[model samples]
Target chain A: MISFLQIDLPALLVGTLAALVCALIGNFLMLTRQSMLGDAMGHVVLPGIVIAFMIAASTATWVMLTGAFAAALFASLLVEFLRRSAGVEPSAALGAVFTAMFALGVLLLEQSGVARTSFDVHHILFGNIETAIWPAATGLSSLFDANALANLPPQVARLGFGLFIVALIVILLFKELRVVSFDPVFARTIGISPRLIGAIVVALAALAAVVSLSATGVILLVAMMVCPPATARMLTDDLKTQVLLSLAFALASGLLGYAIAVLLPLGLGYEISLGAAGTIAVVAGVFQLIAMIAGPKRGSPRNA
Target chain B: MTEFREILAVLLLQAGYNTTVVMLGAAALGAATGTVGVFAMLRRRALVADAVAHATLPGVALGFITAVALGFSGKSLPFLLAGSALTAVLSALCIQWIVTHTRLNEDTAIASVLATFFALGVVLLTVIQTLKTGGQAGLDVYLLGATAGMLRSEAITLAAFSFIAAAVVAAFFKELTLVSFDTEYARAHGFPVRVLDLLVLALVLAVIVIGLRVVGLVLIVALLIIPPAAARFWTNHASRMTIVSAIIGAASAYGGAALSAVRPDTPTGPVIVLLAFAILLVSVCFGSARGLVIRALGTQKLPRRVS
Candidate 1:
């Protein structure tokens, strides 16, 4: 139990927190028909981290997070510019910008020889979730100890803060976001700037993506952002219910996935654990699949 | 002076048989992707290829495991690629099903499928690591491509498959153009719009699977997107646009491969993508048809608006 608390608890907390934050913002993204923007942000975060590492000469969490956030913002603005100015379609613009940024990151990573040092390409892709251990924790009692709390992995704190910010933004701007997501022309007539709300939502998503990145990596971040909300969307018609249900789904997937990753191998007599983030993503997918088949609105003609 | 001469030799395909083959293969893959990408973009399915590319991961891992289990070398390119094609097609169908059956939009379906499938691939990869297989070391090349270490057989297979894909696009050119330009009209005229859509997707899958060894999956979508997108700025005519897009794609890939040959540290996939983006940047600014510069020039020639 102590070993599990020391090693598994912090990793699970970080992963679950990451999933929650991403899914929270993902509801709005899905409603706005911009779910792929999460994918783009996830891809652009790589270049941001690589550039941050190059500039700061350090891998501090804040530095990398800031870099990733900036990159995401820049990519978003560039996509907008391409759509408006260059006459590019939104998806193609997004595809071009993010891939180019990602390619740039990979190129910079190779040229800087960072792949040979403390960081590697796989670390950037799959992340180091298994290494997020809280060595100071002894058991459940350690949760109340100040020292133990201080020794908690940085990812847990970052992701916790991210979830708080995302939830706060969603709560505070719920009406405006909904109006813009459902009817931009109506929002404009009512004096709400859809573009500003869109930017805010994109910024919030970038925040969730950058913070979740260390725990879930780029690919799993997209899954967490997309799958949970999509599952919730299938089950519910109300936006609030969708948001709440998505959070529940994200939490459930995280816990179950982490448990399966750790315990399944042991039960089967294997010595190795599966990738926790990937397992979480797969579990989230399963949930979505189930909802698609059996949800109340699954076969509704409203969809057509 | 000698370095310059060597680069020139590489450019001219005089850089030895291995280098020549790899460059040509990349070029062929690029041309095919560009040709197919035109219809995809016209049909607004450009990002579907992104989802398809990402979804190839689990297939690759499964292929590796299955090959090893069957007592074949896990590095068998054919088996691995066959695995990827199966899943790529599966993922496409999943997107179609979700979009058609549910309230979810295409973007949401693409994103969810991409993330889920890639995550499964990652899980399978970890499983592969635990198997103690010696041939599992280079499977990551499918992520970002390592053209420098490509086998001769792999290079030939890539080139041949790419040529076939481009030819397929050429053979179906009129039908595809009609479908992309006027889907409703094509449907009314009795063309199998749905099958052609799948055909476009299948051609895209073919390009991605073959290009996996050179450009890698992550950036292969760029090959399918950037060249055609860049070509769009140069010509309004579909046929000319296809030719221009293919030329741009071929040039970028050929140049990138040669450059990677000259500098072993530079990976092939990123270099090619960067080269393609540079062309896109140039086209966006100064192309003859829809270039920003041309637009600016045309606007300047207009008479001043009355107050």
Candidate 2:
């Protein structure tokens, strides 16, 4: 139990926080039909962190996080530029920009010899969730202890801050977001600039992606940004209910996935543990699959 | 000076048999992907190819584990690629299914499937690590591509698959062009638009599977995207664009592979993509059809309306 408090608890907290933040922003992304932007942000964050590391020569959390946020913002702007100026199709522009950035990140990782120490491609992809142990925590009392709180994993704090920002944005701009998502033309007629709102939403998504990246890794970050909201979308037509359901689903996936990752191996009499992020993604996918098959709102009007 | 000479030698195929084979294979894969990419971009399924490319991870891992289970060397490229092909097709189908059956849009489906499949692949990889299978170390090469250790047979297989994919594109050129340009019109004319769409996706899958060894799955979509996107700046005619895209793709792959051969420390996949991106950047600036320079100059030369 003590081992669980030190090791499993922090990992679970970080993973759940990452999931909640991603799912929170993901609801708007799905409604706006810009889910792929979340995917693009996930890929571009790699170069941001890599360049940050190159410049600062430090693995400090803030340095890398700032770098990631900048890269994501730059990549989003590049995608917009390519679409508007280059006459490229939106999907193609996004695909081209993100992949090129990712490739650049990988090349830099190799050429700078960063892959030899401190970080590598595998670490960037799978993340270090298992190492996010809270050695300072002694038991439940440590939860309220200032020293223990101060020593919490950096990812937990980052993701918590990200969740706060996302929830704040969603709350403050709920009406504008709904109007733009459902009818951008209507939003523009009503004096709301859909473009500005779109940019803010994209910026918020970038924040969510950058903050969640170190805990969830690239694949799980994308999954969390997509699967929970999609699953909720399948089950409900109401925006408010969908957002609430998605958060619940995200929390559920994180907890259930971490539990399974640790328990399944022990139950099978194997000492090896599964990947927490991967398992969470899988559990989220399972929820999505179930929703797809059985949700009340699963059918389109024509199909119904 | 010596490094320059070595790079030149590799480019000219005078480096050695191994280097020549690998470079040629990469070139073939590039041409195939670039050719197919034009249709995918036209159909607005460029990012869908990304989802499919990412989905190959689990297939590769599953293929390795199965190969070891069957008493074959787990490093067999054929088994691994075959596994990737299965999952790639499955992922594409899942995207199609979600778009058709659910309220979720194609982008959401694509992102979700890409992430979920990739995460599953990562989990399988962890499983492989724990299993302590011999030769499992080689599987990491599929993630980023390490052509420095590619075998002769593997290069031949890659070249052959690439050629077959390209030939299929040539055979269906007109039908594909028709469908991509005007899908509803093609359907009105009783053409099999659905089948043609599937064929384009299949061609994409073929390129991805073969290119997995050269560019790796992570950036293989760039081979399908960057070259065609660059080609778009040079030509408006579909046929001309396809040819131009193929050339750019082949050139980037050949150049990137040769450079990697000269400087073995650099991974092959990213170098290839970076080279493709460089070509894209150049084409964006100077190409004749829609290049920014041409557009800017053309607008300047236009007389102001004297209404």
Residue-by-residue lDDT tens digits, candidate 2, B107-164: 8999899988998998888878788668978888888777888898898889998899
Of candidate 2 chain B, the 10-residue stretch with the lowest lDDT total is: B298-307
Q: Model 1: runs farther than 4 Å from truth?
A: A116-118, A139-141, A301-304, B1-8, B302-307
TM-score of each predicted structure versus truth: 0.95, 0.96
lDDT of 2 by residue, A28-109 (tens): 8988888988888888998898889889998777888789988987887888788898887777778888888988888888
| CA shift of A27, model 2, Å | 0.4
For residues A1-304, what per-residue lDDT tens digits would candidate 1 score against the true structure?
9999888888888888888999999998988888988988888888898888888987777898889988887887877777888887777888899999999988888888776764666766775677789999887899899988999988888888888888888899999988998899999999999989988988998898888775668867899889999999888778889889999999999999999999999999976659988899999999999999888876655543
Candidate 2 stretches greater than 4 Å from native: A301-304, B304-307
Query: Model 1: what TM-score for its first chain?
Result: 0.94
Using TM-score as the measure, the top candidate is: 2
